[model samples]
Target: GVTRSHSRPKVSNDNPYSEAHFKTTKYMSDYPERFDSLAHAREWFDAFISYYNHEHRHSGIGLHTPASV
Candidate 1:
């Protein structure tokens, strides 16, 4: 329901929420500070999304993967 609203810097002092979510989901406690400079973060984010969509089941989605549902 709540999507990007403030494109202007004045309107939104905080960063865009979707971008923020991506950064949070991609970067976590276990990941290295520097992941091969660039490839590492991208690779990990890809893997994480794959696992989240396919391998990781959620009860909220009737216990089915988001892709499957």
Candidate 2:
């Protein structure tokens, strides 16, 4: 089961990593405004995750992809 955070609402500082990732995901030029279907959303996320882990470089990791680190 997924654990729920007990932090107050509207507070994003508790998880800076996820907040940064979400910001990146939303700001992508290819990001869609809406998903046409559940399958579509899943497919999009799969591609995004692949690119994120394998190709995207992170400054926090010295500009290396997560998979390489």
Candidate 3:
């Protein structure tokens, strides 16, 4: 079964966790100003997802990587 968010329309703060992740991605030093192509974007996101799950530590999760949790 899947649950749906009941947040109001046009509410950007409806999901704090996702907002936080977006902030982290935007503020990354290596983040590109613009991806060259769809393939390039995919490659970058694949690497980013790997690092986010395997290397990035979250304080809310007791500083453990998502993969370790």
Which pairs of residues collide in model 2? none
For model 3, the run of ten residues with the poorest summed lDDT: 5-14
Top lDDT: which candidate number? 2
Question: Per-residue lDDT tens digits of candidate 2, residues 28-64?
Answer: 8999999999999999999999999999999999999
Ranking by lDDT: 2, 3, 1
Clashing pairs in 1: none
Clashing pairs in 3: none
Candidate 1 Cα lDDT to native = 0.70
Prediction 1 TM-score vs. true: 0.51
> In model 2, which runs have C-alpha deviations exceeding 4 angstroms?
1-13
Model 2: lDDT equals: 0.91
- What is the TM-score (0 to 1) of candidate 2? 0.80
Cα RMSD to the true fold for all candidates: 8.3, 7.8, 9.1
Report the number of backbone clashes for model 3: 0
Error of 2 at 50 (Å): 0.3
lDDT of each: 0.70, 0.91, 0.88
Of models 2 and 3, which has the larger lDDT?
Answer: 2
RMSD of 1: 8.3
